[model samples]
Target: MTTSTAAPPPPPAARAATPPEPPSAGRRRQRKGSMRRREAITGLLFVSPWILGFLVFTLGAMVYSLVISFSRYQLATDTARPAGLANYEALITDPKIAIALGNTLYYAVLAVPLEIALALGLALLLNSVRRGAGFFRTVFYLPKMTPTVATASVFLLLLNGSTGAINRGLAAIGIDGPDWLLDPAWVKPSIVLMTVWGVAGTMVIFLAALQNVPKELHEAASIDGAGAWRRFWHVTLPLISPAVLFNVLVLTIAAFQIFDQAFLLFHRTTGTGSSDASLFYAIYLFEQAFRQFNFGFAAAMAWLLFVIILVISIIQMRVGNRFVYYEGGDR
Candidate 1:
């Protein structure tokens, strides 16, 4: 038995080899890489249209404007001659340009803050209402949906000198209203009034922003014995500040352009074709290039305005970081 066991102890020399790992995981890695490559290619294809459009259309126009700004350009003929800084020099000394700038500044100063305050107040009031909230919101937003032409026309009829509703209403109240749209002294105010009419959109923005503000924060303020105004100053105002800045920037630009309203309103008011009175920058630029055939000067004015708006926007953007309270941003 011992001899047989000793013979059996000479064990098998062949050992089982490790089975080769399935190729599935290596195949999976290759497939994953292929998928990632496909996705990247698809993303690039998606953005191609925008990239092409900007290069061919938008950037082209912007660059063309810059080139023409330094030259005397003729809109009627496709001819342009280099004029260096002559057009810019003219704008600097032009009395009409100075007046237009002043008027624009005055309009912005009067309208921007008033529009914001009014819109914010309206939003707050709308927010406070429990019933018929949707109705009030619709009513507020209706004027914004109206066409600019239609709104301007309505304002013209309502603010006209003699037969206007405002003066008639004033007469009924035993007080005479001054010729609102006609008087140069009152023209800006009239524009301001019309400007306010279109503030419903901005109010809606503020309303939405206010609604997003934390109820818990407001609750805390209330628990801390804060009054309405105090809570608004402490919590609500800070929360909606970014919206305020956005509206201010947009309205400021719109105020500077001041075209459609000024065009329709000025023609109706002065009947004088902007005659240096209601000549805003845009109106003046239009008169120069289209009406007066001073394409060069118009280009110069356009460039100047572009620069002014750029500078102002940059300044506002820089300063906004100081005051604008963005939720979840690095404070």
Candidate 2:
């Protein structure tokens, strides 16, 4: 009773009134959500044409072919009749399939390494040139721009048995040149030579890779008393190994699917070439589909080729990952 009663304290709700939300934060959240939605829509719209084309043309054709591979598709009647594993079984039993596959493997093994080496050499040469590099690059890349049909025609003339320019040049050097197109032993090599002509594309790829290599690394290596060869082997090659791996894979696949040049050079009415040496898998597949009307078998062959390419590519990537160096520290 010594003093008057203290003023009553404020209520808890009045003392702890909730703070209003920051107006800018709520607006920012809304803006971000709207922006994301807009970006997603725009991305879809940009890719719509490609998606439609792929679904209608590529994916649809692939599915139809897969179905046909299980049936005996008759182009004459425009019909497909189920035959189960017969087409697949024929792949195992067919001798021509084995032969064609062997030839393809041989060509891939021979051509891929040669093309890589030639492309790398050309790239190094172009990189070393201080003058007229652009002109030389254009001249070199001209072969890649030349149409396949035209290249085949040119090679057909150049690889002729007796009077070709290649043989004449060989004769001038006191070396006997083999008949490139006509002889069984030389048929694949002839194709390999033709394949090398268009390695301008591969060269350009390597050139870009070489240009990307940090000059500082080269200088550092040089400062460490590294010679040219040592610098290339240790520093330059590791940096460009990815490009090498890429070109090797692409060239190998192309070699496996070797078709146009072989067909143009050696195709006959019988669908057999000089001793079947030039009867590549693609040629055989084309013959099965078009000439023999074995659509089912051809489709099966196409699938088989695709599987082989897929498996080989996977193997290359697995092996390449071990050696290929990326600047981003990713395999």
lDDT of 2 by residue, 256-288 (tens): 989987887788434334857988999999989
The CA lDDT of each predicted structure is 0.86, 0.91
Q: Which 10 residues in a row give candidate 2 its minimum summed lDDT?
A: 267-276
**What overall lDDT, based on C-alpha atoms, would model 2 receive against the true structure?**
0.91
TM-score list, all predictions: 0.86, 0.91
lDDT for each residue of candidate 1 in 210-243, tens digit (9 for 90 to 100): 8999899999999999999999999999999999
Each candidate's number of clashing pairs is 0, 0
Candidate 1 residue pairs in clash (backbone atoms < 3 Å): none
Of the candidates shown, which would achieve the greatest lDDT relative to the real structure? 2
What C-alpha RMSD separates each model from the true structure? 8.2, 5.0
